[model samples]
Target: MMRVKNFAHSTFATTNHQTMADAQALLQKADKKAASGGGGGFSRFFGGGTTNYEDAAELYIQAANAFKLQRMSKEAGQSFEKAAAMQLKTDEKDDAPNTLVEAYKVYRKTDPEDAARVMESAIQMYTAKGNFRRAATNKSDLAGLYELELSDIPKALEAYDVAGEWFSGDQAEALANKAWLKVGELAALQEDYARAIARFEDVARSSVSNNLTRYSVKEYFFKAGLCHIASGDLVATKRAFDTYLNLDPGFMSTREFELLQDIVTAIESADQELFTEKVFGYDQLSKLDKWKTTLLLKIKNGIEDEPDLT
Candidate 1:
């Protein structure tokens, strides 16, 4: 007989190892009944006409914990996947997607391909249930997995856009903004300046319209300006700067903002030396971030060649 580890008013948290052993034995019994089409499995476990796959799912979860405790990552993930599948077969649809996500977490560290597969299953389940918020969150996770683990930028970008669409449709403004920001950043990384600028501008306008935060609008405008600078569109950068000044009530004439105007002025006066010096000066004072530095370098490279568009 197994000794009880702890007991409360109406429940207990058993010792995991003992529970694992018991669950393994029960799973064997369940597997035989499941295969034989006997009365021992889900169809009769709860004494109801409705199936009760929860018993099998609980056993699978216990087995997963056992494997995880033994440091067998692959087996643990497989067991969790089994649990998720069993959960889906039950009447509890909401918990099934969550169970699949648990399997995904187990697989993510050991096998990204397996993780991606599990995440796709979770996404489908959530979408089918019209749980757009959860679906969008899972899509964002999948996007990160593709970008960071699988090194698939195009797929990552596509996933982010899909996540953004779901968030937007669900009227989740903050989440939608985050998803679209990823899409914009990826577009900028791919040197698609126009698309990046458009995405940033849209978010910035939305932020203003919804009265989200002035700082957020400033940051988006900052990003849009960098993208315009990257595309060597000095006129557009100036216009974006003007729009930011108009919107931000707390606007100050910082060197970061001034550099945009200076760069425009330098190009109009045909002074490549002045443009370079002003940009470098801003870097010395404010220390540009890597993304800003990258776009600034691109601007400096083409500044002398591109005619004044102001």
Candidate 2:
């Protein structure tokens, strides 16, 4: 067993060293090709001599792959960035954005800021090319990196909002709704209930016309109601609830509607226990997600924050 282990370790070390050397060699050749400013002797003779960015880009990609094989994510990401730049300089503008996406995927594992930066470049390229769908998709990804990786809530919210608009303009209502949901959830986290409520209401209104999304209208209105409750506007909450019922008449029969009604009643009476009970009861039947739980807690806290008339 010891002999076999020793052989395996030797083989692994040899392979790793060879891979490193190969990557270095490829990188050096790529640099030389980029600086040469001429394709080759034959191309010069044919009057077609020019900077060989195409070859340089391929070499950079190969080096990036080699770095990835060695688990050098940062190096791999940098190589991919170079490849993307080279592709942009060549006639391969279409491929440059994809190369940047490759860079983003690698950078996200090691450096979120770098990932966000490259993703923005990819999004800009896609938009410039009139590929709003791809741009919107990357914007959503960029928002996730900001929200989850960097914890930049404001930037995340902005990115999600832009993505939602782009998706809506592209007629990708489902994707737009998904992005808007994130915007609403984050806005609520920031105590921007008006923004949250508006986003949710917009989604609900848009969804009511689409058979595929109509079923989710109730959930969106429920969320908007929760935001209104959190904002301590019972009158507006009641008004919004009435509007929701009118918009989706079937919502009045849902457990979500019941919970909202019960919570509104509990808040009016300053009954925290009743609020908790209503939420708990609804949770037992239908599990509340983190966003819902958070907003519910905020609404519950508003009860205690309210001044006692007595």
Question: Which candidate gets the maximum TM-score versus the true structure?
Answer: 2
Count clashing residue pairs per candidate.
0, 0
Model 1: lDDT equals 0.76
Model 1 pairs whose backbones collide:
none
Residue lDDT tens for model 2, 104-136: 999896899999999999999999999999999
Tell me how many residue pairs clash in candidate 2: 0
Using all chains and alpha carbons, the TM-scores for the candidates as numbered come to 0.78, 0.94
Predictions: Cα RMSD each: 6.9, 2.1
Cα lDDT, model 2, residue 140 = 95
Q: What lDDT tens digits, residue by residue, belong to model 1 across residues 7-84?
A: 442253345555556646755754543343324455466552224356667767777777676556677788788777
